[model samples]
Target: MRGLVTFEGGEGAGKTSQIRRLAQRLTEQGETVVLTREPGGSVGAELIRELILGGTGQFDPLAEALLFAAARADHVRKKIKPAIESGSIVLCDRFYDSTKAYQGAGSTVPAGVIAQLTQIAAGDSRPDITFILDIDPKIGIARAGRRNLASSVSADRFEIEGLEFHKRVREGFLAIAAAEPDRCVVIDASRDVDDVASQIWLALEAAKPRFMRNAPQIRLDPKTDALVDDFAQAMKAKLLASQVKYGCSDDWLVDDWEGECQAELANHVQKGDPRDVANYAAFCWGRGWRASPAA
Candidate 1:
């Protein structure tokens, strides 16, 4: 099967250089490779990129996120999926992970909203393997600044974001790697280019066998489980409060209570894995929220 390989990192992580090198190596091995980047993979996406990276105009965080999701949707449809279907390996310099890390983590957008947007943008498609080049944000931004200085090009919006912003981005990448250890390989981008490439190669070698097998299942974190429980309790509390305030009869109570519970569950379901969460939501929706019978 054709594979999708994503290389992700903060600015100055040498993602561009390394991806180019990897593309060459793969091409030399007689594998067809399509190399692309996020925010501008297609023509429409390129327009969105101009708006996002120009720094000339202010855009709300959620608005920017929606723009990213729109671009990604088009890119996946026009470029990535077609390439993979044609037996070509797609090597993306960045992808959805960048959005989650940069826009979701760096901006004021709520994480839940970003998660839902990501699900919609990606649909059923996800990278077969992801290579996250990790480095200190300070070092990375310095490297990027030097490169910009050498090229006599002004810093773009993202490049102009101070070290702290980039630091958050770095942390975001690491968090993603931690969350999806099986799919994400963290490489030390602070090392020499050759060393970084070697690490990537080793990672790919190790991952090849797994890729050939069925897709790996993702495990839920205990924190996520706790969040679910907290949501349920909150729903229960809200329903009880509403019941006391409105003084509704049993029929009205069941209907209104169930509606409120479903709404709360829906909000949480959007952010979390829909497996158990969906089941729980379905159970709650089917069995209307009812108070215990009077003693």
Candidate 2:
């Protein structure tokens, strides 16, 4: 089941760390996870990230909102949408909610304008769940500053903003969470890292089943279906040939092999990992399929 999970908060709210932890957990459960960030993710969006984050006071509030929306449009179309279609759970660092918080509340941009831009850019790719890592603006800023200094990375445009700006951003996120209780989970990020992560995981565990149940069924393109079918036939042939080669095979061995092959093919196709299907085909075509010692 593919899901779009987003993390939103003020600066240094531990979004990166928590996102990684969640991704690892999901991956361990055999989910295909795509970790990405907004203002970036796609190539064009990344260029916009460099332009927007690298420059200070270059864009007015409305312009900044527009820039973010433009980047988000590219990101959704190029990266987020494709990954979801391919059955990958996309864990995003930020999404349009950042535009609503930073550009709308933290700046002079109107909420209506921000919403319009977000809808246009994001289309139907709304997040399945959003984690608002709430923290005091001052503490978050200090943490961001220390992180930048330690990594020898200069403060980006928003990181350089004053305390009042960050405070507004924090409030913005909180307001969003309150407005959309069903979609958002506000995590108290001031707690210990493990505590915060535990809260997040618990919330995710509770919500994931519902999201998966509501997720659209996996649909394969004609080309992909054809590829899967071809691989299925080829794998069956290879397994039968191997059984014949090893003359001591039981009469039902080839039937068992075919059933197993079909099961694997169904699993791979349902997961929508075309690469896995191709790799399986390659494995069966190579010497590995026939190099086994007699059993």
Candidate 3:
């Protein structure tokens, strides 16, 4: 029953409580669950976590992003990778999407660069499923304040942030969920804990069996790579031809290619062709405006 599931949201989204509940239920089902969180799951990572969260360092957004990447690299090497390799069902309170929301889309950092940093940190390892808890920023902020007032710990940098920041983070999370619908599930955190947990359980029950029964690390052969390359090139060429057909400018691109992209990825995924799936994902990820230095 080896797999990884991550819960992500703004502060006061009840991610911690919901994750704990899910972990307890799964453990009772006789699964070995490795419950953890980021940016500090491993010991070394915890040190970094304190430096970031405790506000001792008070680093800028970019520096904080780098620190997070470092901590995540260590966490993956020391804890997450090992647990999953041992066939444990790993439930994480937060993961890469936190960085993506807080530091990337919600901040000044380029989302592409953050995406690259994440790739470097975790390699090809990605969460098998991610749950994004959606809630109103106003209610969420008040809830977080009350939590801080009640708990032993005070509000850290992120929790101390203003309403606008929380709103942006929520939008960032929603964007991620929209971009990767298959890999992410968005639940309305405004609902009561029981209802949210029930929805989460339904999602888990549907997906866990597939992961446990058939999850395997896929490696593509040279022939498969070539075929995928051809397919990708063909897609690109078709898009280019479409531009010519429509008499578009050189800098112009499709306004809404996501539907086609999603359909293609879903096709490969449904066919259970891992090589094709990997290729399709890689191609789709490279979509949108690419960086090009001007002369």
Q: Across residues 1-295, which tens digit of lDDT does each residue of candidate 3 receive?
A: 6778999999899999998999899889777899899999999999999999999436888999999999999999999998988768889989999999999877878888899999999886789889999999898888888988888678887887878888999999999999999889999999999999999999876665346332344466777878766765665555445446654543333444444444444445445345555554564454341222222
Q: Candidates' TM-scores?
A: 0.70, 0.74, 0.72
The digit string of per-residue lDDT tens for model 2 on 188-250 reads: 999999999999999987675445333443345777887776865565555556545654334
TM-score, candidate 3, is 0.72
Clashes of 1: 0
lDDT of 1 by residue, 1-295 (tens): 2579999999889999999988898788777889888888888888988888887437887888999999999998999888877667889989999988988787778889988998999887799899999999889888999999999987777887877888888888999999999999999999999999988887876665444322223355787977766765665555455546655433324344444444444444445444534444444444444444332
Per-structure clash totals for the candidates: 0, 0, 0
Instruction: Go through the candidates in order and give each one's C-alpha lDDT.
Output: 0.77, 0.81, 0.79
Q: Which ten residues in a row have the lowest lDDT in candidate 2?
A: 283-292
Order by TM-score, highest first: 2, 3, 1
Note the residue pairs that clash in candidate 1: none
RMSD (Cα, Å) of model 1: 17.8
CA RMSD (A), model 2: 9.5
What's the candidate order when arranged by decreasing lDDT? 2, 3, 1
